[model samples]
Target chain A: MTTEDTPNHRTRVAAERRGKTRAKLLESALLVFAQKGAGAVIDDVIAHAGMARGSFYNYFRTNEELLAAVADEINDELLRAIDPVVLRCDDPAERIACGTRLLLHTVRRFPLYGGFMARLPFPAANSGLLGARFLARDVRLGVATRRFADIGWRVGADMLVGVMLSAACSTAREPLSPAYPDASARAMLRALGLDEVEAARLTALPLPAFELPPSSLLRRAQLLSVGRD
Target chain B: MTTEDTPNHRTRVAAERRGKTRAKLLESALLVFAQKGAGAVIDDVIAHAGMARGSFYNYFRTNEELLAAVADEINDELLRAIDPVVLRCDDPAERIACGTRLLLHTVRRFPLYGGFMARLPFPAANSGLLGARFLARDVRLGVATRRFADIGWRVGADMLVGVMLSAACSTAREPLSPAYPDASARAMLRALGLDEVEAARLTALPLPAFELPPSSLLRRAQLLSVGRD
Candidate 1:
């Protein structure tokens, strides 16, 4: 047999195919959840994916499991997309504003992702994933540096997340003013104890370019949304 | 014919029965929406109500109609409960604070209502009903009197509604610290341009007793929740 037909190559090819199938399922699941909220069943997902029931069961056993997997994928992709810019901000307040604006912009760019997020209950949307790590990290830093008032991280994160998620939910339904993200960030900062001037200035700072690799969930959601349509 | 069997008596009895059936359908819809989010179908609602399909169509033609009817009922009940206390407070800032706290308390006391609200997307939660009239009135008064920063009523309403709804959503899933509602209101006031001291003092004012009439939606939801259990 040729080198390409070796057992090692065969196993690698099979694994690659399996990975592709899993990713496709995730993409389809996102679309389904976006359209139907958390109540979507496995049949809906499999139909959206054009896959048989057996193939879906191989990837996810229940709607909850599939939703959990989708949340993880979103966190990972979002973390990747925003980490670079967030890490570059020296001031915790700036990082907070930047993160808020970037998230809103990302949601606006991918209405499907926003729709999925809009349908999520607050706890499901914020718990142990999206807000848990990234926002929590920034909040801790802001508190330690005295950039934020001494409110505990939980309260601080709640204020920021509440405004951002609500705004994101609004954007999902219709186009918001271009100024909405900045205004929302400013309000969050003000709630965190930044003076009006400082809050306005930070939110008004030029946002660095937001880049999502083609492999990102936001990108996949965009493509999948079009394909499903 | 006997007096009880007269045509007018029969007509009045039929109307009362129809009203009772419609109310039962709404309560069931609340439970179904709470459990399944907005994606719940007519079959699920009818099943929850333990009624036949024909009965459901007589009340609501679609899930959207059922949700709309539920929302209107909630708004009417909430307005009645809060209007007395809200009118007693003359200060626009105080009205905002009182409104925020009352909404949270209402949600916490009636988790079925909270769950239904928690499942709602932001626009669906706030648009044309919940935030449209009562909160909008307070916001406009606050803005006109310069109690709130001169942000347009839309932005002002957005800040208040965003924080309140987010807090309500969180309260739906779990019990929060007793201070959560006050803390949320204080942050909202701050976002609306109140000083921290004033914001705190306003929220700390002894909230007037909240009373939902025995016939209120909150009471019905409470009873319905026990019945469903």
Candidate 2:
């Protein structure tokens, strides 16, 4: 056999195919989940991705595993969108406000991703997750600077999760106004023990443009294939 | 025929028996619901109440209907527990803090009832039920007096909802401290646009002793029946 038919070559090709299929399945699953929540099954994902049902076992063993993977990936996307803008702030309070406002903007702007996020286990309990980690970091910084009142760190994080949950659930019921994110962030800052005027002014501060990572080529190509079919 | 065997007496006795059976079923249903969450079925409830399976249809047509009735009853109990202490305060801010702290106390003190309340629809959306309405009414007063800064009523209500939800969920995970309710209430007031100092002082104010309504005779006796069975 030629070098192209060698076992190593065949294995590498198989691995690449597997990676592509997994990406396709994840993208399709997220889209279905956004529309139908986490209850949509493997069949729903397969129909959405236009894939053979037998092939799904190579990637996710169950809908729950697939959903968890989607939750993990989306949180990464959210962090990527937020970090560039928020990481620049020197003041802890500003960091908290700006970071939160960006999160709200992302949630409002791309609802499907946010909806999945709101369904995950309480964010504070799993602070290692990207969203809560950023918030906890900012809150800790605020306490160090004496900018925030010393509510316990976990309590602070939990409150922020509660606020985001409130915002996410409210937004889902109806589209949020341009001012809603600003108002929501300001409210949480107040809740975190910011002065009313400062919370209001900080919330009103102009937020910079933030963008989530561009959809991967695999995701785009697979979604395109679905569209074509 | 004997006077005791008259048609009216028989009809009255039959109605009373039906009422007692329904009450017995509801109390058993709630206890079962708390132990097993919402999934415990009519059969489970009937067996727990020591009633025939056929009797369930006479009170609740379905398990879901029974669950809704339980939710309604619990909200009423929560309101009865909270309103007297909270409604006595005239200062809107003090009123808000007291009402909510009492709610946190209620939730912390009664785990099974609290757990069921926590699982209801998003607290902000259904704020009229249970503790939220008192919180909302106080917030409205604050807004009217301009004692609170001018965030709209719903946002304030929503933020308080966020705070209470945070407290409820966290308290569920672990017992809250004696000061947890105070600190949590202060945090929400700050979030509601109060100055941090004022919020802190208000939270530290002596709260009236609050008590849940004593269990109705029906409930106590029905529970006693379960214990006997």
Every candidate's CA RMSD: 4.0, 5.3
The numbered model that scores best in TM-score is 1
Off by over 4 Å in 2: A2-67, A83-85, A113-130, A216-229, B1-70, B113-130, B216-229
Q: What range of 10 consecutive residues in model 2 chain A has the weakest lDDT sum?
A: A121-130
Question: How do the residues B58-172 of candidate 2 rate in per-residue lDDT, one tens digit apiece?
Answer: 7888776776677666666667767777778789998888888787776666555544444443422144544466877788889989988777776677667766666665654
Please, what are the lDDT tens digits per residue for candidate 1 over residues A34-92? 88864577899899888999988888887767776877788787877787788898888
Tally clashes: model 1.
0
Q: For all the predictions, what are the DockQ values?
A: 0.33, 0.35
Error of 1 at B33 (Å): 6.0
lDDT of each: 0.76, 0.69
Which pairs clash (backbone N, Cα, C closer than 3 Å) in model 2? A190-B190, A190-B191, A191-B191
**Real contacts recovered, all predictions:** 0.34, 0.42
lDDT digits (tens) for residues B1-229 of candidate 1: 9999999999999999999999888888888888787558889988988899987888888777788788778878887778778889899889888988888777667777767777665556666434325677888998899988766666666666666666656656676676667777787788788888998899889988777888876688788678768
lDDT of 1 at B175: 64
Give the TM-score (vs. native) of candidate 1.
Answer: 0.81
The i-RMS of candidate 1 is 2.6
Interface RMSD of each: 2.6, 3.4
